[model samples]
Target: MDLLEAIRKRRSVREYTGEPVDDAVLRELIEAAVQAPSAINQQPWTFVVIKDADRLAQISRKAKSHLLKASLSEPAHSFREMLNDPDFDIFYHAPALVVIAAADPTDWAVEDCALAAENLMLAAYAMDLGTCWIGFAQNWLATPEGKAELGIPATYAPIAPIVVGHPRRPPPPVPRKNPDILWIDAQTHCA
Candidate 1:
């Protein structure tokens, strides 16, 4: 698919078919991810692919538990109920999880990883695959126990915990908001 088309149509998929995603396809998505631009060419991203159904479910459970105990007073109330639910799979039963990480906690690492993640997500959508970046897993995945369980390195930071799988159905397009522009020309006076 064309890059712009992918950009416009790509959605954060929640429902997924239970079929396993091919390794080659995952590799292709990672290759596409690495092609993304990085700050000062740090190219600091690392990946951990978890295709084990048991493990993804385990992580999902742990993540939900962790989020439930966290402070969910007001804004976090949005997730309070779902996290409390016994059957809400954080990964939505996706067959693959491609975790994007940063080797070092540098200033630009998160930004760089975010760009790579966007690339990976777009590539998945273009290939008729669905992907969702699970933010609920981020905090737990950063903990020592979470790292040990996933075999993630001690110093590495889990930037994006994305689940990849076949979509149960095509997600309807969500409308985008118009950009709030502040165009400043040479003739415009400084504030």
Candidate 2:
């Protein structure tokens, strides 16, 4: 699929069929992810793939509890209700999760990982797979226990927690509003 087409069609899929994504396919997605341009060619991203069902549920519960307790003091009021429900999985029951992490001191680490994540997500969409960046897992994943659970080093920061699997159904397209633009050509420049 064309890049623009994939960009337009790709959606943050929440529901999955519980089918495990193949290791080869996951490797292909990672290959695509690493192809993303990095500042100064640091290429500092690492991945942690989680396919264990029981572990996924366990982490889901822990992360949800952390978010609920956190929402009390923070401004995340909108997520409290959904986080309170035990059945509402943050992963949407996907069979695979690929986390993108970068070394703590790596310059432009967050931006680099985000670029890689976009590549992975677009590649998944083109390959008839689904992907979603699980923001709810970020904070917990940074904790020491969470890091140990995934075997990510304490010196690395988990920037993207993406779930991957066969989509249960194609998500409906969401409309986009016109972008606000500013023209600063010579003709439009202020005197």
* Best candidate, TM-score: 1
Put down candidate 1 lDDT per residue, 1-191, tens digits, no spaces: 79899899999899998899999999999999999999999899999999999999899999888888887669878888888888999999999999999987888999999999999999999999999999999999999998898797899999999999999998899999999999998889986
Tell me the spans in candidate 2 whose CA falls farther than 4 Å from its real position.
72-75
Query: Would you list the clashing residue pairs of candidate 2?
Result: none
Per-residue error (Å), model 2, residue 162: 0.4
Candidate 2 per-residue C-alpha lDDT over 1-191 given as tens digits, one digit per residue, 9 for 90 to 100: 89899999999999999688999999999999999999999988999999998999999999999888774555678789899999989999999999999965577999999999999999999999999999999989989988998997888889999999999999999999999999788688575
Q: TM-score of each candidate?
A: 0.97, 0.95
